[model samples]
Target: MGNVIKMDVYRMLRSRSTYYILIGLSFFLVFLINNSHESLLDSQKGLPVPKAIVGIGFDGNLLSDQMSLLQFFKVFARSQSFILILAIFSVLFINHEEASGFTKNIAGQVQKRGWLLFSKFICQGLFIVLAFLVGLVTVLAAGEMSYDEIVLGNIGQLLKEVGLQFIFHLAFAGILLLIITLIRQAIVSLLVSVLLCFGAFAFLYHAIDRWIQQGLGIPDFTMNNYTITGIISQVSIDSAKGQLIRAVIVALIYGMLTVGLSVTIKNRRDL
Candidate 1:
């Protein structure tokens, strides 16, 4: 397993897309902060601020002028842009082996073929963490340079939020891995992942929730509450203990189930 992981890391380092994604994310963060700074200047000069800047908050409320480091982190973390970037990266990264005809050679050499899939999943998780840190540092540096008084509020709370976001994101990557493994097509996987990031299946989830509620004779049984995306949307820095616990549970369940199914398929099927 360790050897497999090392090889995966080597491939990741050799790939240009890996660095491209991270570089793009940093530029995106800089753009966001620049826009926010311009909006702040406009508001101070008694001019109208754009609706886009006004709606930057997670709750669709006006962004506070005194944006704390925590608030900036939350805004970036909650946005689908981060997940979308990681999804595309994972799809391309996982598909590269099959596309380059490297999978056949690697599968024959490994004692347990399933370890290859597992190693890829583990490496994806590591990349997700690295991306998270990159975004965090970008936001901190950009915020300091843009704003006059950005507070460093509660380091513990900030770390907790970062940890929760990482788990949720890793689980999301697992879902994409399962899709890419089953479909074996990068384009199709990318389309599905983009749709998921944009909440394109929201209606489907709502319909399922209604059906389950009617079947169980329950007034408020929502399937979304137990879904990974739903859990992510509901969680926040000020979320209650119960909500946080539910988020962790849902993330773990989805992550484990998807990885397990993908590994089983890989082991039982011809490579």
Candidate 2:
């Protein structure tokens, strides 16, 4: 399993597409941060209303240094709804290998199919950590230059944020991996994963919000847990414990169900 994981990481780093996708995402995020900088700077010019980052509706207040980190995160979180960066990377990084027949050749040498897949996912974690940390540093350095003194979260909270987001990406990527592994094609898995990651989540966000306010008398979708990153960033520890539990249960069930289907299909497919 360790060797499999190492090999996947090496291959991932070597892939030109992987590097291209990472470069594109880095630029996309930097664009967002730059746009936010301009908007906020303009709004500070004798205006009362705060300029919103990607329009998450921040009232025009200069973020304290610590809260500036929060603002930076909020900007990224708003764009995350599209699953834009993640979808691109996971598709080309994971599914493209299978579609191009690299996975089958690698599988010939692996001891266990599931372990091999898990190793690939682990490689993804490494890939994302590098990308995310670079992005975070970019935002933090730029934000500090523009704003007042602000200490980002403690190391533990920072790691929690990264780890949780990483898990979310892994879970979503696992879906794409499983789909492509079973179907042996790239297009369908790519489309389905993106649509589910973005489109379905959009629909569910609305539906869940309406249901919660109407049924439970709680008007806070910000405090819900149907989405992993959202649940962590938006919800408080005391207010959303139930949603947290529900999120875990749902994530596990969906992950297991998809993985089971993939394994079943792989066993019967005679590939």
Candidate 3:
């Protein structure tokens, strides 16, 4: 597994397409952060920034009307675009390997299919974290360039937010791995992963919440609460203990189930 992870990481770093996407995502996230900074400053000029950031940390000093570091971080974290980027990263990572028949070659050298899945998960998870760091730096640079104040708000809270993001992205990688492992086609797998992630997940959340909870009269049963977005969406320093626990549970459940199923399919299917 160690050797497998190292090789995958090496291949990922070597891919030109990886760098291209990194450059494009960094620029786009920076633009988004800058644009949000202006709008937030305008609308929240005299308001108290919500103490509990919805997905990260909120601006504690909204009265000053400047974009603080935490608020800027929140801008990037709370956007669904971040989730889309993770899905794209995972899909492309695996899809490219499949298209190149690299995995088949690896299977010939390994007996345990789980080794391949685990290595890909770790490698792609690392890519997600690095991509997020790049976005974070870009946002900070853009904020400072635009004359916004950079407040390194509670370090503990900032670290917690980053940790939650890491878990979410890792689970997203698991989902993509399952899909690409089953589909084994580059364009189709890419399209399916992106659409299922950004579009289908949200739609399923709504349908279940509205139909199952309200129409079926199932008290306190919300499918959205278990969804990938729903789980990650509840992360905040001030969120209830129960909510945070639920988020962790949902993330683990999704990650394990997807990866486990993928491994089973890989072991049984003819490569």
Tens digits of per-residue lDDT for model 3, 1-271: 6788888889888988778888877877766655555546655566433433222222333323455555555556655556667677777777676678887888877768668878888877887777778877776666666644766677777777778777876787788888888888778888887776444566667777888777889878877577776555446556688987877777888899998998888888876
Pick the winner on lDDT between candidates 2 and 3: 3
Candidate 2, which segments miss by more than 4 Å at Cα? Answer: 38-67, 81-83, 144-153, 200-224, 227-239
Give candidate 2's TM-score.
0.71
Question: Which candidate, 2 or 3, would have the higher TM-score against the true structure?
Answer: 3
Candidate 1's error at 50, in angstroms?
Answer: 9.5
lDDT of each: 0.79, 0.59, 0.70
lDDT tens readout by residue for model 2, 83-173: 4556666666766666677767877786656666666657655766766766677676555555555466555655655555555555555
Kindly indicate the candidate among 1 and 2 with the higher lDDT: 1
Task: Give candidate 3's error at residue 88 in angstroms.
Answer: 1.8
- Candidate 1 to truth, TM: 0.88
Q: If ranked by lDDT, best first, what sequence of candidates would result?
A: 1, 3, 2
Judge candidate 3 at residue 117 and give its lDDT.
Answer: 78
Q: Any residue pairs clashing in model 2, and if so which? A: 50-60, 65-150
Q: For model 1, what is the C-alpha lDDT against the true structure?
A: 0.79
